[model samples]
Target: MAEALDQARAGRDAAGTALVAETRAVVAAAGAMSARFRSGGRLLAFGRNGGAADAAHVAVEFTHPVIVGKRALPALSLGEDPSTLPILGRPRDIVLGIRPAPDDLAVAREHGMLTVALTMGRRRPEADHVLPALSEDPLIAREIHVTMYHLLWELVHLFLEGETEA
Candidate 1:
């Protein structure tokens, strides 16, 4: 039991370290996403298997913000079929792929959409922004990804609020 606890603690520490290292990138991504939203662009997220759930969660967070009075942004989850990205995607859209295929991101880029990839450090997909997982364990990686996306959602709102105030 103690051994399991130690491993969990280590994973949490690793995730925090990785997030701290990528703080700049995360802020940049949120800024970019905010720009897209300001331009009337929608967020289109996609993933497969377990990642599909993550994608859906992202979409919900953006479309139905838990915070009261927060504006609901346009967002959608493509589920397992990213092939439709080429069809559903628009030039000003933001494509968020959670452990998605490289080809899917490439298509989004080709369509002039901004692409973001949440990777497990195994495969690097070409994207405007890439958030790589630090822990080798899948569970830890998922936890990191969840935290990253939550931060992104919050920061994007912050940028939008700043723009409105300005």
Candidate 2:
């Protein structure tokens, strides 16, 4: 029990550190995402293996908000095959990649879409914004990614509502 508790505490500490390190980038990305959505843009998320699940999760969160009264936004998960991105993506769309292929991000950038990458390793993919998980454990890294995306969703809504009032 002590071992489990220690591991959990370590994971929490790592998550907090990673989030703090990337706070500025996350805020900037959320602002950009809000702008894109305000301009009638959709969010296209893609990943492979475990990342595919994350992509779908992100899409559902935006398209089907669990919180009542919150606006639903357009979002789609491309799953493992990102080849369709070129066909489905639009200039105003936001592309979210979780450990995605570099070429896919490049294509999204070329098409004038906003690109955000969630990575967990030494190699960082090119994107408008990159959030890298600090933990070496895959499970912990995934937790960090999940938290980061949730933050993005929440902040995007905050920015969107704020802009509406302004």
All predictions: root-mean-square deviation over Cα?
Answer: 2.0, 2.3
| Poorest lDDT segment (10 consecutive residues) of candidate 2 | 157-166
In Å, residue 148's CA in model 2 sits off its true spot by: 0.7
lDDT of 2 by residue, 1-166 (tens): 9999998898779777867988988898899999999999999998754799999999999999998878999999998777887899999999999877667699889899999998875548889988888766667778888998999999999899898411
Candidates in order, TM-scores: namely 0.93, 0.90
- Residue-wise lDDT of candidate 1 within 1-166, one digit each (tens)? 9999998998889777988899989999999999999999999998754799999999999999999978999999998778988889999999999887777799899899999988886678899999887777778889889999999999999999888411
lDDT value, candidate 2, whole model: 0.87
Highest TM-score, which number? 1
Clashing pairs in 2: none
Give candidate 2's total backbone clashes: 0
The runs of at least 3 residues in candidate 2 whose Cα sits more than 4 Å from the true structure, single-residue gaps closed, are: 1-12, 164-166
